[model samples]
Target: MNSQQPSLAQGLLAGQRGALARAITWAENADRRFPQLLEDVYAAVGRSHRLGVTGPPGAGKSTLVNQLARHLRELERTVGILAVDPSSPFTGGALLGDRIRMEERTLDPGVFIRSMASRGSRGGLARATVDAFDVMDAFGFDQLIVETVGVGQAEYDVVGAADTVLVVLCPGAGDGVQAMKSGLLEVADVLCINKADLPGADRMVADLEEAVHIRTAGKGLWMPPVVSVSAGTDQGLDGLLEAIQSHRAWLEAEGRLQLSRQEQRLDQVQRVLREGFDHAIWEGRGLEGYARAMIKASRTPHGAAERILEQLKAALPSEWAQVQEETQP
Candidate 1:
């Protein structure tokens, strides 16, 4: 946490590709120096395109991400991949098997890859994914691809952090259209029918197109185009890349790109502030006092939360005072 340490983190943030990998490591761990490192990373960040890839399991998101990285590298862009994997139930460690799918990029100096374990976070993305994105952004990567652990519909937290979101789906997945109805379909900037060579691929595409049309009936914004690709054979990659770039162009033309980035940064600030408040509330002797209060108010959980918030507001730093007004009930 010293000035020298943060200076070193800043140095690493500015280092070539190796700096990206190191930044990811620093962001993922809960080191005490993390806050300072994050500040340094944010201070050095610039305009980097962040693409979020999400879908249900078996959607071939990993394959798509690998292909996308290769495509970006071909275009002479420095690429960073943050692949989110679920933690092993027994070992409590990430499988980290994405490296196998991304073998082609191993020797590519322009590409940096890191695997993160979800740790059963509610969003199916590790809490540090956004921080890792900023670190990569600050390290001068032109493109940062965040691949979510697409376990369920709610795993679509990537949309808030990404400039363009690709919701990848495999053909013939049971009730594909129904899965999108809950909200995921509405958030997609692009829909990818990965593994398109499989049977029912066409049907899935048709169904998704109809569903998207039906859902966005009144909205004038461009409807998300569905692109089919067989990642195994590298089919339709060019079209997919074109679709991704087209969405970026659309966002820029519509003036949504800068808006999206601003929203994402503010969202992160809110989340960080909430976490700081929560940490301060639970630190020291308050945890024991809270347990006693909880036991006394067994029938109503509200008592402890209300009391905690009041205490939190009173103890918060001056900067947090401005946030407490909205955060407090």
Candidate 2:
């Protein structure tokens, strides 16, 4: 702890566990040392396989991740999980109840589970998540799982980071397949119809197959497989894991893995810039004053937002001007 940044970087590169913990803490706090932490951990990058699990709520995403983590540990692989939970809009505190579902693994030395509050940071996660992944990667975890806020198109951000994104969907929800069709169906590298014991499992699987056939049509990519599993019963997990391994094999065999990595790198850069710019806008004051004025004058938040954004735009870095222009109507 007494050492300076260079020494700390050396310690981390040497695989000192203490330095890894300190680095993760610093990144989570959004400390000024973050960029340096990433720099130090750069050599450790590309060592971990990033897997993202997503889907509608109640699709057993957490359970699937837990199962996968245990499977990886059995292979002597260390695992890190970033579980994104919704924050209370009123209090900014997270429910973070995922711990209950993962009680069996709490004592496992090979697994590290971290719950992150979405923190009003939209797009399915806090901006610091990629940094958090870097911390875990540098800490020598062999695999990392990022589980995003369920539902909504924005949650597909996970796909951008993952080598393979498994979209979990289950039967019994009134509109489960419909919900999948909306956005979940498109980005998924693997589709799981969980709770296979439930009624309509066959129907859901058939629906998903048809959806994939239509979407991918002739792309010649390994068709995203539709898997059925009953997580509660611990059924079909091995097959699910096999499917994941198969997808990874296909990625490597077809040379898409490197492409995925390249896309992920570009995505991280864009996301970091976007979040930094948004944080700057929200820093000095709450938006309450502007909201109140808009309500009083009967103007939409959209109009006021445009004016405020124009003001914020002038001070933005030139690179962001391109982003602003592309987003403009």
Instruction: Give the TM-scores of the predictions, in the order they appear.
Output: 0.88, 0.81
Tens-digit lDDT string for candidate 2 (1-329): 33477776677777676676677667767787778768866887887878888887778888878888877888888888889888888998878977677777787878888888888776676667778887788777888989888766556667676888888888866454584557877778888988899898998788778878887879875789888988787788888888888888888886788988888888888977886877865677766577567656657767876776676678669989788889897
Reference-based lDDT, residue 199, model 1 = 95
Over 4 Å off in model 2, which ranges?
1-4, 7-11, 14-18, 175-180, 277-329
Model 1 / residue 135 / CA error / Å: 1.0
Residue 64 in candidate 1 has what lDDT? Answer: 86
RMSD of 2: 4.6
Clashes of 1: 0
